[model samples]
Target chain A: MRTDAAPSLAAPWRKRRTTHYRRAEAITGVLMASPWIIGFLVFVVGPMIYSLYLSMTRWDLFTPPRWIGLENYQQLLFNDPTFFQSLKITTIYAFVGVPLQVALGLVLATLLNQKIRFLSFFRSVYYLPSVIGGISVAIMFRWIFGTQFGLINSALRVIGIEGPSWLGDPNWVIVSFILMSLWGSGSSMLINLGALQNIPTELYEAADVDGAGTLAKFFRITIPMMTPVIFFNMVIGIIHALQEFVLPFVMTGGGPADASLFLVLYLYRNAFQFFQMGYASAIAWLLFFYILVLTLLIVRSSRAWVYYEGAIRGR
Target chain B: MTTLPANRSFNQSSGQLKQFLIYAVLITGAVVVAIPFAWTLSTSLKTPQQVFTFPPVWIPDPIAWWNYPEALSSQPFGRWFLNSLVIVLVSTFGTVASCSMVAFAFARLRWPGRDLCFLILLGTMMLPDQVTIIPTFILFRELGWVNTFLPLIVPAFFARNAFYVFLLRQFFMTIPLEMDDAARLDGASHFQVYLHIILPMSKPALAVAALMFAQFKWNEFLGPLIFLNRSELYTVALGLRTFVGQEYGTDWHLMMAANIVFMIPLILIFFFAQKYFIQGVVISGVKG
Candidate 1:
C-alpha cells in the first residue's frame, strides 16, 4: 500500500506540471478572447440589461428615466394600434418573403449545380445585387417600381400589360418590398449551392444504378440529404426577414398606408421619429422574445429531421 | 430491359425535350435576375427626357454620359465616396483583426470554461440588433460617439461581429493541430503562432470575412442613419437619402448615377473575390 501510494503521489506531481502548462494555455486563451468578452459585456450584455431596465421607465434624451413599471408594456400591448399593425405587417412579410426567397434560392442553386458553361460568371452576376448596399438596391428598385417612367412599367408595356403603381399604391407596396428581397436571395443561393456540391456524388451514382430517374433521385437522395442545410437557411432567412428594415424604410417609408411597416422599422420610427423611447424599448424586447422563441422552435424541430448520417451510425 | 427497344427512341426524344426544357427554364431565371441590373444601367445612361418618353428608350439613341458627372457634382458625391471608403476600410480591417484573434482562441487554445464562453458568444448571435439598438444608441451618446465613426469602428475592433468570429473560428479549427505543436516545439509564442502560422494558412477565410465585412459596412444604412447627424459625415446610404426629401421629389437620374458609383466598388470586389467566396463557403460547409 505504501509503495502504491508513493507512485500515485509522484503521478500527481507529473499531473501538476501538465496542469501548469494547461494554466498557461488558459491564460493565453483568455487574453486572446478578451476583446470579444469585453465587448460582449460592455456593448451587448451590459446594454441588454440596461435596456431591460430602461423598458420599465419613461426616459427621453433630455430627461432622466422615471420608473413607470409595466406602463410601456401596457401601452404596447393594449394602447398602440401601430404596434399591432406593425406586427401584422412583419408577420405577413416574413411568411411571404422568406418562403419565396428560400424556394427561389433552392431553385437557382439546383439550376446552377448542373454542368454548365460560365458557371462562376453567372453566379457572380446573380450575387451582385446582394453585395450592393441595401440602400442602393432600395434606390434602384424605387426607380424600377416608380409610378411613371419606371423600367418595370416600360417592360410591362412591351408585353401589352399595364403595371401597377408599385411603391405608390398600398396594395402593391408590400409586393415591391418582396421583389426587392428576391434580388438579394443570392447569398442563400450560394449556401444552397455549397450544400448541393457536398451531396456526395456516390449517393447519386448509387441512385442512378438503382434505376432512379433524375426527379426520383432528387426527391429521394437529394432532398433528404439537403434537409439540414435547408433547415439552416430557413432559420437564418426567417430571422433576417423578421429584421427587414432598410429596404422598406428607404423604398416605401412604411407608407402607402403602412403597407410595408415592418416591426423594426416601426420601432425605429417610434424611438427616432416619435421619440417614444420607453415604448420602443418594449417593442424591442417583444421582438427579441419573438425571435428567440421562433429560433428555439426551429432548433427543437430540427432534431427529428436534420439527419446526421455519420453520427447516427456511430452512436 | 430488352422489352423496351421499340420505346427506346420515344424515351430518347423525350430526354432531349426535357433537357431543352430545363435549359429554357434556367435561362429565363438567369434573365430575370440580370434584367433589373441592366435596366439600372440603361436608365442611368438615358437623358431625363428620354427617360420619360412614352415608348421608353430601351436603348438610348444617345447615351447621357454627362449624367455621371452632373449627378456626381450635384451633391457632395466626392465626400460621400470618401466617407464610404473610410468607414468600409476601417470596419473591415477592425473586424478581420478582432474576429481572427477571438476565433483563434476558441479554435486552438484549451482553456477552462472555453466551451462555455464560446456557447455564450454563439448565443449572442440569437439576439437581434433591434433589442440592442436603443441601448447602444444611448451608450454611444453617453460616450459622445454619436456623429462620428467611433460607433462604427470601435465596436468592430472589440469583436462585436460574432458571426464573422464564428466563421473564422470554424475555418481555423480545420487547420491541423500538428502545425501549432510544431511551432511550439520551435519556441514560437502563441502570438507568433497566430501571426506567422494561423493567419498565413487562414488567408481564404480571412479574405472572405474581410470582403463580407467591407460590403456590409459599405452598405450599412441603419447604423449610420441612427448615429450620424450631419450630412458631412453621412455614408453613401445616408447621403442618398438626402435626394429623397418630402419637400421635393427625388431626382431619379442623379440618384441612379450615385447608386451606380456606390455599386462599382462592390461589383469589383465581388468579381475579384468571387473565387475566395465560393471556396470559403465550400470549406466551411465541409468542416461543419
Candidate 2:
C-alpha cells in the first residue's frame, strides 16, 4: 500500500517520474515525516535505550547511573515480598478480572444482539463509565461503595443485610476493583456486538431447521463464532488489567495491607515515590517480559479453541 | 388462515412470554448499569445531611443548587477546565493534522523505505509506555517542560500516536488510487492533493480520530498527573483528586457536585457523538 511495493520492477513505459522526480518525492516524504522521525528518535528510541542501561544500574535522578548487572532483577525476584504481593494482586487482577469482564461483555452483547429495541440507547448507557476518566469513576465508585452511607450499604439495609467496606476492606478490595472493571466492559461489549452482528443469520436459521433450541444454538453456534472476538478482548483485558494503576492508586492507595497494589503502581512508586529509577526500570522490564510470556502462551494455545472464519490450520 | 388448536395457541402465548422475559431481563440490567450516574446526579442536588440517610435519599427535600458553585469555587476548577480545554483542542488538532499528514505520506507517496519505516512505526505501538514514561519525563525535566503543558502537548505535533497513524493509513487505503493520480495530472502536488483532496474526502476517518483523541485527552490522567504538579496548572482529573483531600471528612455533597460538573463534558460529548465513539472502539477492535 505504501509504494505499490514492486516499483523496482516497473516498466520504463509506465514510469512517469524521472530520477529527479523520484528524488523530489523522496525529499517531500522525508520532509513531511520529519516530525515523526524526530519524535521516534528523541521520545521513543532514545528513552528505550536509556532505560535498558538504567535497568541494570542504580540511579536516582539526582545522581549518575551506576552499573549493577541483574542485581535489581535478583532482588526484585528474591528479596522483595512486596514485589511478590503486588505481582500476586496483578495476576489476580489480570486473570480474574479478564474472564469476568469478557463474560459480562459477551453476555451483554448477546442480549443486545437479540431482536430487541432501543439497542443503541442501552449500549450508550452501558459504555458510559468507560468514556469517563478513571479518576472521576474512581471517586464515584468510592461513594457508591462507602462503608456507611454508600448506596450499596443503604440498599443492603433495606434487605436486612450489612454491606461490608468495599474499598476499605482488604478482603473485598480486589472484588470491588473487578466490579469496577465491568463498568468499562462496555467497549468489549460493543466489540462483541459488532462480532455478533457479523455472524451469518443463515447459521442460526440452519440451527432452527435442525430443531436446535436457543441454549443449544447459543453454545453450538454463537459462542464458537464469538471465540475470535472474545480472544482479542481477553488478550487486551489481560494487558490492561496487569497495567491498571488509577483506580487502585486513587481509591485504595494500594493500602489496607498493599492488597490492591498493581504492577504499574508499584513501578510508579519505585520510580517516582521512592526514586528507585533503576529498580523501576527493572520492574518495567519484568512486566514487559511477563506480558510477552503470557501472550505467547495464549497464542500457542489459541489453535485448539480459537475459530477463525476462512482460516486454515497448520498453514 | 385456519385457527390453531389450544396446544399451538399455548406455544404462541409462550413465545409472547419469552419476548416479555427478554425485555424484563434487559430493562433490569439497564437500570443496574444506569444507577451510578443517576445516584451521582441525585447526590449532587442533595443536602449534606441528605447524602447519607439510611434509607438512601432518592430526592433531597431542598435541592442545593449552590453545591455546584461551592464545589467550583472551592478550588481553581475554572482554570483547570480551561487548561483541559486548551490542551485537548491543541493536542487534538496537532494529532489529526500531523497523523493525517503522515498517513498521507505512508498511504499515498512512494518514498524509499516507506514500507520499512511504516512497519517500524507500527511496531512502536507494542512498546509499553511504562518503559518510555520515565525517560520522557526526564527529557522534559531537562528541557524545563516539567510542571507545564509543553510536555503534555508537544508530542501531538510530532504525531507520536501510531494507532491514529495506522487508522488514518488504513482509511486512506480504502480510497481509490486513481483519485491521487487524477489530482497529480492537474497542477496539484502531493501536499495539495492531501490538502485539497484526501482530507476533504476523509472527514469521517478524521472525525473519528479527532473525537477519540479528544475523549482520551479529556480523561487522560497519568501524563497530566505527572507533568502538571502546580495547583493552578492542574487539570480537572487532578483537581478532583486534590479536592478529595482538601475537603476531607464527610463532604460528600460538595464532592458529588464537583464530580457531576467534571462529568458533564464527557457525557455531553458522548451523547452528541455516540457514533464516532462507538466507531472508534469498533475500528480498534477489528484492527486488533
Q: Give the CAPRI rating of model 2.
A: medium
TM-score of each predicted structure versus truth: 0.93, 0.94
Model 2 Cα lDDT, one tens digit per residue, B1-288: 112224667767767776787788778878888889889888899887777587888778798899999989988899999999999999999999999999888877768788788888866866667878888888899899998899889999998887898888878877877787788888788789899999999998999999989988988888988898899999888888875642138577888888998889999999999998888888777656
RMSD (CA, Å), candidate 1 to true, equals 5.5
Q: Which stretches of candidate 1 lie over 4 Å from their true place?
A: A1-17, B1-7, B245-248, B282-288
lDDT by residue for model 1 over A86-164, one digit each (tens)? 8887877777888788788877788788786678877887677777777888777777787666778877887889999
Q: lDDT scores for all predictions?
A: 0.81, 0.84
DockQ of each: 0.50, 0.50
Candidate 2 per-residue lDDT over residues A184-239, each given as its tens digit: 78888989998898899999999877767667878899999998888889987897
**How high is the DockQ of candidate 2?**
0.50
